[model samples]
Target: MFASEVLRSVDNMASKRSNTFKVLLASLAVAALGYVLRSPSLYLRRETKSSLGYPKDSLLNFTELTAEYGYLSEEHKVLTDDGYILTMFRIVKARNCHRAKRSPPVLLMHGLLQSSDSWIDSGPDAGLAYLISDACYDLWLGNVRGNYYSRGHVRLDPDKDPAYWKFYIEEIGIYDVPAMIDYVLNYTGFQKLNYIGFSQGTGTFLVMCSEKPGYCDKVKLVISLAPASRQMHTQSKIFRTVTQTFYRMEGLLSMTGLQEVFSKGGFSQEFVAFFCQLSGVTERLCEKVIDAFDHVDSTHLGSITNQTTRVLFGHFPAGTSVHNMARYGQSMNSGRFEKFDYGREQNLVLYGSEEPPQYNLSATTVPVMCIYGKNDGLVDTRDVEWLMAQLPNVLEMVKVEDPQWNHMDVTYSQYTGDTIFPKINEYLLKYTSA
Candidate 1:
């Protein structure tokens, strides 16, 4: 063949290759832009909203409700060793009831994405803060780091710094729990405080006991309500989807400044509140949406006043680390309660192991009473039993008698005060002088 003919053929092939490379680059650019545009927080705004049925006597925040209820409440700013500034609230006593100044202190820690408001959103009639105060226990509510109330940090601003988002349940268990516990014990002048935790609250406490067993000595009797660990058997498909699919987007989302999950005043929460209050068809479906994730006890649903549901959800899923959600997902996949997975190579560097270390449940030596519902989907019965077996000193396991008593109902249900609190009160009474 002629040299020119051969050169011409080579040039044509080079031209074709150039065009293909250009197309590939353009496609990648479009895909990156698409991911940026699809911000996770805004994904839920694709709906027409009418009303939220916001309470006529809506309370603004935990402190606001404390004043409205005439309860004595104080807010404390605790600085974690890891540079997170967490907010914790305390209810000294019930204003309506006369209690001795020396009332025993009880610290109630809320679950994942929840804040101090969880204790009071049910109103004075049934709220745990009020009932505890009325029961003569100096009640305190703790907001874990990354929630709405505890979003501040000593060195990092959550809104502006990506580094601020570099934590999960492990950091919370190790840093936030111990800091808050020490703060509460110091402030209350108590040798040890009675402790109660719900969901992630229970998980963090258990983590604290394992990572820092000394804290367990400061807790008199730990009550775990709907304890969340090893979510292997979680019934909520959405929860599992989030732990799996949605969590996979965290790196991309955070790169676009969407690190905070379920951001307040964001589209997702607004859409939920608005859609949940529609008159007939949508309303029932919305209620079922909640029931599907938690249990659907009609009696409890009936007791959940419009104001309660409206106010409670407004503060919930408040915010947390993307890593936190991802870790929970890993737990579901691995069927073991363990530390966050930072890939295999990174895990070796960070943890000196190929896989993340399982939380040392055996190190949790506190006298623990686990209260779980048969219908609780988040913490399956089998998972709770596994948690019980792992704990070194689980005193008892109380299964909620009401077959339909799902997770949230343990705190927000209509009969929570009657059915659950009595048992809790009895336990507290038994250990009151301890």
Candidate 2:
């Protein structure tokens, strides 16, 4: 009898080891395929570079690019309570425009795996940051903790410290957003500041209000462009697949200490940037690659110009922790906008319950204007309706008038000046005394 019990235990252990090995192998293949996709050099011909002109903007950082466009730019650093050192950018006004009247401060936060660059990447005419500044609003851009611009900590090394990469959207809401809010208001001496968040940026602001209810009093209004929280009905199968791959491999990744993904200045990101520098056919193909990730149809590609596409690759796929990706996966699967789930055992310890807590959307009392694309691949209208129903104060819900507008179009679309910015400006004017 004792021998039989020992044999059963041995078999269980062997089965567990075999399962772990299989999971690791499959996860590695998925990771390698992603890297290969970004590595355009492996598949493309050398002649493609013949006519390609290198984008000078690729080499320019946020402040440099702003200055190049004749905008007065300033950089400010804010240290989070938990030791993250984030860099925030400000466009005080156009260098050429001299308005004696002081503009009210309005903070613009970028989405996941993006930095301050997204707002200005499309140049002065269409870029949200430039337009807001041109309108005499004090424009401030906020970068989350782990992206390209804000990769610093008081003690831990990003490259060496696995602990440094352990944060997700929850931490951004509870720590990063509040820190930026306090800094911008303190420096500008404003009682409140307007906020504009794109994609995950919207999620972070919602999380902030949900987690720290008092912070809602500090915002005059929130302009949510392509707002996303739960992606349960997202149309982008590719994005869902990638998120699931990371979610399933979390245990193995935690064990191996592999935490960050698509880091800025990494080989994959740089190669994608180089490939995008090639003009004509190659650039068009690169746009298709972006389209697939965005889950937009081919017809939707008309909204973004070739130059905008090239400039976009220069700084995008910025970087985020693996845990952050997994958090999205959790929401996608469970169809709930909630805190990070740490498995049944760890969740009990951290949350005092087997299930993670759902964000209290009712606590978000700030007047919000939600602008979403009908064809957005990452956020479905159903989810947006669900979110609206939960919120106590939704000032407006404006779907992009353009039928082809998708997730990327919210920031990079050439038609935003005609399609969306007017409404944004109108909403801001209503809330501002200036």
Candidate 3:
């Protein structure tokens, strides 16, 4: 009997060994496949896009998405002084409102991994783009250099050129934002336009104002939503992990020839985009994934339906330089809002200092209003307080009234029109002629 029991235990041990071996072999096979393919994609195997590396309609832009919703979106290509060609979307007419003959031009800039698509993702009534248009403001959405919408350049190909990816937030401040501002001002024939920036948008604007004090005169007022300047006090682990290990991990990623991080071609991106498109169990999983960083509020789920969520993820994790993420990481470690750190020797050569210089908030002369969320994990209240203390012309500051409001909710909440937009439009009206 004892011999039989020992034999049974040995059989169970063999079964466990076999399962472990199978898992190891499967993992190796996947790694090999990913390496051979030069990329891993769930659907795309062949290269379809000819002008650039990606396929057309492979991802939709703000112009395309907004037009589908019965809005007239004009696609404008603006050339940056640094040679990048950026696509900026303008929503001059919407079904909800007649074309504004004399309304002010409002430039709404998105955050990290976000583009103009984010503004329209929440549907017409609640989406910021539609709401702004409904409010009779001529809405313009700005896309930064490296995002999916604005990936073109006169000389540098984002998929091939390593030098194109060398810029961080400093460049976005000095180049991208200024370029967009000039383009909008020139296009609309306006002396100054209203600026609304979220996260990195706010960061870039802050940097732009600091570097070129005269640019502040070009903006009537600044509406900063979830303003991400000093991320030192961020609560999200994902934000912490990326910003902290960025120096080493970014180098490894760049060495792998990955200029665009988690770009549209990857299996991981497709998988997440597809799975989040599903309802029931899949959507719940997506909620958990987004909530891990932004914090959870079930009421805010309507802004991110399956269809809209797919568009958001597909266009997003969009693509940016490894350096931009690294810049945010640098901000997480540093005390003051400053330029990118090039360590010691490079810092002296670049900024004539051993350390990166702080952005002069005193020069951000535009009347500013900051709207922060209580439950936001990425941008904390402490960080917002620090930012407020430094800036000279803070017009007003308010927390999202909802106790459960998180970072994502500031954009994704279906109730934002009811709760947030009234306040935003109030401040924007102060500068507008109407």
Candidate 4:
């Protein structure tokens, strides 16, 4: 009787082991099938780099890419007041410039999760940095702290110290922007520089202008592209869902010590590059996914061809802290452009109230030109109008004539040359002294 009972027990254990092995095998089979389906060569005809007309090399950094296109480039390091160090890039010579004298300095700031490379990623023809340089402006591209290019601090290490990644957009507005502005002004000997900001770039600029209105005098004109403020009316379903998820998972992320997302040399960017480059089908699918977040359709991805999109993936989502994403989530939840919400208890300690304080947009006295697209998925037109109402000095508000133009279109689309850069040039030319 004892031997029979022991045999039964042994059979049960073997049965459980076999079931687990089958499940593991099934998972591997599914993953392999998916990879095969997404394979570039087996699924679609692959296009060579020469056919695409972009550079043959993959993942070239900013200065190398600029030099590859026959443009002279220089790099600068900016030390912020708060111990963070940032890398700034400049197009020292414009290919098409024939003017004897250099125009006043123009500084271009990038949006969230991006580096200064965004300005030149689309190449000389459509890139605003190249265009501004060709237009005879001393163009300077500034990278915010915590991105791929500017991930340095005086004391804390980003990889080891939790305190190193504690900053949000407000810190950027108050410290990063001002430091870069001062560095550019002193370097160029220009009293003021024309500013062009896209998405989060626009938000940080507003924060800088509002918090330190004196800096307003240091900016001759602000060309805000897709001003990303008051995002209560955001249209992207994917964006809404993601922000909500991030908001809910903030505590979990903090507990797990996962402070950064899409960071340089991180898994997020590597996965993106691998998944997007799998095949033409996957590339289109990738575009569709971006469209889901930006509410952009296939029609709007005009100049962002497959090759260009792949190259962009190599540089994009450079990096940002989870804290910054959570702040955006907080704004989405409250539907107000306010300071970081530290919950009721912590908010009381930091802000002297249960609720976080709102940025005083009324204090922004800079000459501003607000540019937005009608179909932008992330930033609703109503929010832009609401922002315009709050600001004290709005010079002009120009809506892009293209009906299908979306958020990323402002920076990456070929249509920007005809649809936006002309107006940007007019404003910069009007405000600057040759």
Off by over 4 Å in 3: 1-60, 296-307
Given candidate 2, what's the lDDT at residue 332? 88
Candidate 2 C-alpha lDDT tens digits along 1-434: 22222223223333445654344334333433554122222332324433356576656788899989898788999999999999999886585456643445889999888888988888888888888788777888999988878899999998889999899999999999999999999998888989999989999999999998699999989998888888888877667776777788877877877788766666566566676664464565566556655744545546788888888887887888989988887788877889998889998999999999999888889899999887887888888888888888899999887777788887888777888899999998887766
lDDT comparing candidate 2 with the true structure: 0.78
Q: Give residue 208's error in model 1 in angstroms.
A: 0.9
Q: Write the per-residue lDDT of candidate 3 for residues 245-350, one digit (tens) a residue.
A: 5654666777777655545556656655544544454444445456554653323433455445544665656667777877777788877888888789999999
Query: Which ten contiguous residues of candidate 3 have the minimum total lDDT?
Result: 1-10
Report the C-alpha displacement of residue 374, candidate 1, in angstroms. Answer: 0.8
- Each prediction's RMSD over C-alphas, in Å, is 12.9, 9.9, 8.6, 10.8
Tell me the deviation in Å of residue 292 in model 2: 1.8
What local lDDT score does residue 181 receive in model 1, on the 0 to 100 scale? 85
Q: What is the alpha-carbon lDDT for the whole of candidate 3? A: 0.73
Q: lDDT (CA) for every model shown?
A: 0.72, 0.78, 0.73, 0.75
| Tens-digit lDDT track of model 1 for 144-217 | 87777888887788877878878887788899988988898888788888889999999988888889868888
Q: Where is model 1 more than 4 Å wrong at Cα? A: 1-53, 57-59, 101-103, 278-283, 296-303
Question: C-alpha displacement of 245 in model 3, angstroms?
Answer: 1.9
Tens-place lDDT per residue, model 4, 78-106, is 99989999999988877888875365788
The TM-score between candidate 2 and the true structure equals 0.88
